[model samples]
Target: MNHFTICASKNDTHDIEEGILDTLAQGFVVEKNDSSYLLKSKGLFKRHQGAIHVIADNTDPDYFAKNMPGMMSFYHNIPFEDEQLKELVMIQISVFNTVIAVEMDKEITDEQMQLLIKLLSSIGGVGFLPDGTLLDQQGLVIVYPNGESGPSNFRPHACTKMINVQEATSAQGEARKNNTIAFLVEKGIPYVASLPQLPSVEDCAFKRQEDIAKRAVALLIAIQFACDVAQSGNIEDSREFFLNMLHKYNVQQFLTDNEKSFLQAQYPDAQYPDAQEAVSIAWQYEAYWTLIWALGFVETLEFPDDVCDCDYAIQVVSSCETFEQFYAQIAMRSKEEILDEADKIYRLHWACVNSRINGQAAPLALNESVVMERRRALFWMIGYRNEQWDTMSMDT
Candidate 1:
């Protein structure tokens, strides 16, 4: 069919029809004829026609079983909270009880597409383009069953792709390496100016800036509390303090299992953290340092050859009492800047691993632990592998 189609709840048929007519009436003279609407643009020779067809008393079983699964899989790649994602799924399910198909006669103009999007938002509808691309109610791209998406005018792809880091001599890999070296040199980090790059910002799917900012704030609070628990050694008081901080920031759900384990060790009945645990948790300072830099709290992230300045790291977060206060201070670095750093760090981490395997000194004074920790943070920022914090793979 050479037209645009959208599916919404049958319950919204009246509002959908009324909304489309009212909106089109502003630019096109609209007339109702039975179930169809005919339109003629004012002061122009253009004309268009459309109709709303409601499929009553039944849901599209194929839509629920086939399409929703892929869409839900796509949502898993997004970094939103579980509850938020669940709510989005529920909204789509509600609209599926009875379907209303909206068909437009002419090729959808950008203006008309936007109008459709508004209608979808009003009733939690889903859209299907002639080219087979799917759109959620918010007009965000959701992939089809085969991992393909439509409407080339929208985002280039609906899913993120993994870069083969080992294929350094391949076409994309070569280009990435060249770009990485140039970016690092331009930004004044020239130590690894000779390393190969993995992927650029445009090559990867990134979380929204607002979401990343919130994640950074939550991470900073969690890490700071973890550090305090490590230092105090008083299990009872530190556990209360750490839990209070998590509640205060409303970030109880953001802690990874590793963080939870470390915190749990501080419980009165649990095994007390040994010297080794303290040292390991202290290394999280480097990760926290990277987060602050990404959030623009620090203007620069110095070379990761040594431990980060702990006192300064604590002070930066301690100054912000509320989550909103801390979030307000964030002027997140650009995607290009963050991706460049991630690329550089990824290569540095490989070098560190290679050195250890070969029983040689780490190249360019690189500290394997520091580089690994910073790489984890950078990779998370760029949505590398889309893995959770503790489970993030650091494959060289």
Candidate 2:
């Protein structure tokens, strides 16, 4: 008996077998005696003369891709999506998978990669998801992070995260407005110049780079921490925190009426709801600015003085191909075993940035599996054993 691998466009078992037959009928013979590639189709595949094994991705892809190391065959189909310069686009289409990418030994710069993805999207070769991945019309993510499903029914769309804390500070609001445009200017992404300033607190939301979704889990923690601090911290703490953070981020020009009134009040006697809202707002003001600045900084590839050393981070992330490998090494360690939460988060940030820095163009993120796993583990580690922060509420 021998095993074979089917590389199908679809993610179904029956379709894969039929695809194998079709491919075989087309006179494309399997070079490797032990393995084969099949596109997906419906109906049972005619049994071969001898016993053979077949496997697929979705469940089987990751397992075989990793475990069946010695029996590996790389298949990459380059979809021609960018038609900007017809001939220029063809030049890129010739380089499909990593093996070819590596074989060509051609290094594309980060700027070039960004432009290429945009070009591909224009040509219908890819779609940009709010999740920050590039998908084809068939819903297969052309460029995705590590350990994720490539095909889906859901179409991609531009994503914007609205920071709608009613008590938000001026800095938070402007981060939604000014800094976003600033970032566009910084990154050279074209946008209309006279864009209106964001109106509602909800308007403070902006689109993010796809790789930043690792924060999907961490966001719950931040929200909870804000809620807790809001409930427990004194008015002085809230007022002082917001005031300090707003000034530090220099967003005082954009302060909200509520935030302004609260800071100006002589004897800050805000009610419970108002107080909590204030704390949450203040935290968001600072947090959003910091996040925006950090993300923008990463685009420059120059580590901010406030951030860790890039050389050290590059050294740390060099070994990780996927976030899976990176997590396997760190997940076992207790909170004390590693650096603080900031360090861990930053390391993940670096891991996400690794491919982009290496000229891989589209920065893929950590898979949802790893993101959810980290979320669960961090919840327990943070001692949030209570049901309050369980899956349901946190997910919202």
Candidate 3:
């Protein structure tokens, strides 16, 4: 059986019916594929296929492009009754799924994008729960370093298997004593398992990147909501709402610098750039940023500061056709491999340049503009992941 069921509460059933009708009005038609569900949205540029799945007892369009390895997004259109819950559900789903977002007509700032990367990176490998808690593969609750203590706290209930005792023989011995399966656990501070035999404290970096992308998408959705509210003549209220949202939802603390910039841009006397111009730039630029961030393999691999020069970064990322392709090539595969398979290839491609720094060989000669063009290609790749490439490339 699927993890989620289609049945809803009596009150929600009515909303679901209305949502289905509205979706049909917008050209969505549901059809079953094998044992899965498909909702096809036929438009001029491309026919969007939404793979419907009910996860965590919520239904979403588990999105995929014509060709891609990992799942990209989970979409849902909300009815007016519970829009906030719908929004929260989508955000939580995206966070757990590890989606990478590209640019579109949506207005999302580069500053906001950076914050998303930070938020996801903080989660390490495991994605956050809806309320910002961490969970393991078996649905066991792990400790949240920054989370609040709750009356309905499930952590203690789920951590029945955890064994923590002071005055243990050895540090490694204490870590091994836990009867639970987790990469990391906390005694006083966090303790990471040793290789296959021990529990670990840190999350995997590549997984962290996925969380970053998901949070970015959530931020964009929030920006869209704020813009809609602003359009309704509640500009001050909207702005305040957005401010509060960043404070509450941004668990990774990614918004401090971006929030400051956003407010500065909004002030009457502030040198606010053109809103239209900023929106246009943010949509495409954010996608480009995601691609470059992807190249770092987030938690998996770490690059030296000098390696991030725009030209070199573009060269490293553009060599692959898809994000999955890029990750496959550059990632490292070992017992405790941090990098993805694709990232390893890019590392090898740039081996000579890195060798010079490591005192082995001279750097390769590469063009600046050529590298930037490749970076642009990565933006295009991310668009494909979002199924937005059809805006220019195909017609349904």
TM-score of each: 0.51, 0.22, 0.21
Q: Kindly give the stretch of ten consecutive residues in candidate 1 with the minimal lDDT sum.
A: 155-164
Off by over 4 Å in 1: 1-176, 179-197, 265-271
Model 2: per-residue Cα lDDT at residue 370? 34
Encode model 1's per-residue lDDT on 129-197: one tens digit a residue.
665556776788664434444332231111111122222244655665677667546654422222334
Give the total clashing residue pairs for model 1: 2
- Highest lDDT against the true fold, candidate: 1
- Per-residue CA lDDT of model 3 for 211-286, tens digit only, reads 4333433344343433443344344555566555444434224322443454334545423334553353234333
Clashes of each: 2, 4, 29
TM-score-best of 2 and 3:
2
Clashing pairs in 2: 15-40, 15-41, 57-61, 145-365
Across 1-396, the per-residue lDDT of candidate 2 in tens digits comes to 121111222223454344334433332232323333322212144322222234433344354334322111111112223222223222222211111000001233343234333333332333333333435534455444332445443332211211221123345434445555564456543332222232333322222332222232133223333454466656556656655544443435444354455454655355444555545443432233222223332222222223323243333323544434433443232222211332233233333333333344322334322323333333323333232213311220
Where model 2 places Cα greater than 4 Å from the true spot, the runs are 1-13, 26-57, 60-184, 187-305, 308-396
Clashing pairs in 1: 133-150, 177-197
Q: Which is the leading candidate under TM-score?
A: 1
Model 3 residue-pair collision total: 29
Better TM-score candidate (1, 3): 1
Worst 10 residues of 2 by lDDT: 96-105
lDDT of 3 at 129: 38
